[model samples]
Target: MDPHQANAMTTLSLFAHARALTAALACFGAAAIVTASGSTAHASPPASKKDSKAMTTSKPCPKGNLERSQCMIRLLLDDVAKTYDGSGGGGISAIRALNTTTFAVSLPQEGRIDVLTYEFELHPDGRVAIKSRTPSTQNVGPGTGK
Candidate 1:
């Protein structure tokens, strides 16, 4: 093979290797981001044995269980909003807890006034289970409600 041709082939191979390395790095970076976000969303304080017993026997919030629940829901909703993409105008608006471990969140979609409801289950082990449902649009007449 000509010396010039051999040198050209070597350079091409080097460029291909570099491209592969770059792609691998990009994938790794994406994976890291996903993992970090997931961890942040699920991170919670671990309950000790005594705390677990207290939780089981403790009385519900006296001020108003619903209000207390709403406070917790608001915190979770805030986190969701922070993580959500706001460029599309689709994100969580409110949240309500139906029970100690179950809660629902309201999400607004792009170009729509209706809020979608989502259910989430909070586990003692810092795990969160989320379920999304189809959203219905709000109906409004032409002249507004004058």
Candidate 2:
């Protein structure tokens, strides 16, 4: 695929990952508050009263070998978690190679499972570019998602 198409696919993949992560973290946060309250049932805090705008942000994919690419992705995931007010569990669960130029990574933390699959290719300039991505919930099974 052309570089532009590859970048578009990569962006979609990242978006899926971030959306799942955000939802999972939000659920976890709500659960934590409830558990800490110790049976004193309380209503969830109100949603933001002000208008919320979507954010469009991008960062250059880290360069180098596959291992280094995996490391960089992991660190980026950790940073994203923190941005959503969530904590990381120190490391990811797995970064499995799907092929010589593709990988499937799993990040399990705080009872949630997130999986990101992507193909990477090295540009002529030596920068690693993600060719495509498909992110989903790892723990979700058939008969779920009602």
Candidate 3:
């Protein structure tokens, strides 16, 4: 085997590992922010201790603009998971701040077969007010390309 090929393989493995680690870290950060901040998935906070633990705590956004934006994005991901069907598992592909209160986020495809992107408008408070489900063009994938 060529030394170049071996190097390429190792590089690819490292890249994959890095991506996995980043995903895991993001999930953990979001969970901590949600759990410790008092954000709830339901209408209101749970009354009992057991039920309270089940709820996502919500707190005011961080004072720093950078921290606040990150918090909002994490909260938005939690909201997106509610409508996601566990397809693709790619998570959020892109997010753009359209305005002070509105953001356009690109969602992962429904399945591995399709490369479609769904864009939605999410508020800074993590409330989804608008959603667009239009598929773009035919996605090209390995072994499925024409």
Candidate 4:
């Protein structure tokens, strides 16, 4: 073959290789992004408001005690205010139980008193049970108020 023709073929081949390589790299980058997005989608939901506040404000509970008791109190108070139409007339009270931690608040209005008592029981799995009691008896979920 002529030298000019050979050189032209070589240049075309090199260009093709470069385009293929670029396409491969782009595919890899897209795959990585898709994989990361899928993993995040499947991951656990974001922390609740109470959980975040607890981590930020409360001291770490002992290995055998309730975790973030102070934060729990704040969360409960906020819940009470929301539930009672911004009428949070309760005063918070805390006491150490025989083998647990107890927090109580009294909401007195007119002639009715609503008591919110949270009994915290720490388990081996590092979860706390915040049992809230009102005059009508409502159970809030773990790590949340109201």
Alpha carbon deviation, residue 76, candidate 3 (Å) = 0.4
Candidate lDDT scores, in order, read: 0.33, 0.40, 0.36, 0.33
> Residue 113 error for model 1, in Å?
2.2
Q: TM-score for every candidate vs. truth?
A: 0.29, 0.37, 0.39, 0.34
Q: Residue-wise lDDT of candidate 4 within 18-116, one digit each (tens)?
A: 333233222322111111112211111222334544222222233421124433433344344334431432222111122234555444333344455
| lDDT value, candidate 1, whole model | 0.33
- How far residue 108's Cα lies from its native spot in candidate 3, in Å, is 3.3
**Winner by TM-score between candidate 3 and candidate 1:** 3
Worst 10 residues of 1 by lDDT: 31-40
TM-score of 2: 0.37
lDDT of 2 by residue, 56-143 (tens): 1222444434233433343333333333332453234444555545656566644556666766655565545556667766554455
Candidate 1: which stretches are off by over 4 Å? 1-112, 124-126, 142-146
Model 2 Cα shift for residue 60 (angstroms) = 11
For 64-137, candidate 1 gives per-residue lDDT tens digits of 33333333333343334333333343333433334453444444444443443445444454434444433445
Tell me the lDDT of model 1 at 97: 34
lDDT of 2: 0.40
Q: Candidate 2 — which residues are off by over 4 angstroms?
A: 1-91, 109-112, 140-146
Candidate 1 lDDT score at position 79 = 37
Q: By summed lDDT, which 10 consecutive residues of candidate 2 come out lowest? A: 31-40
Residue 133 in candidate 4 has what lDDT?
40
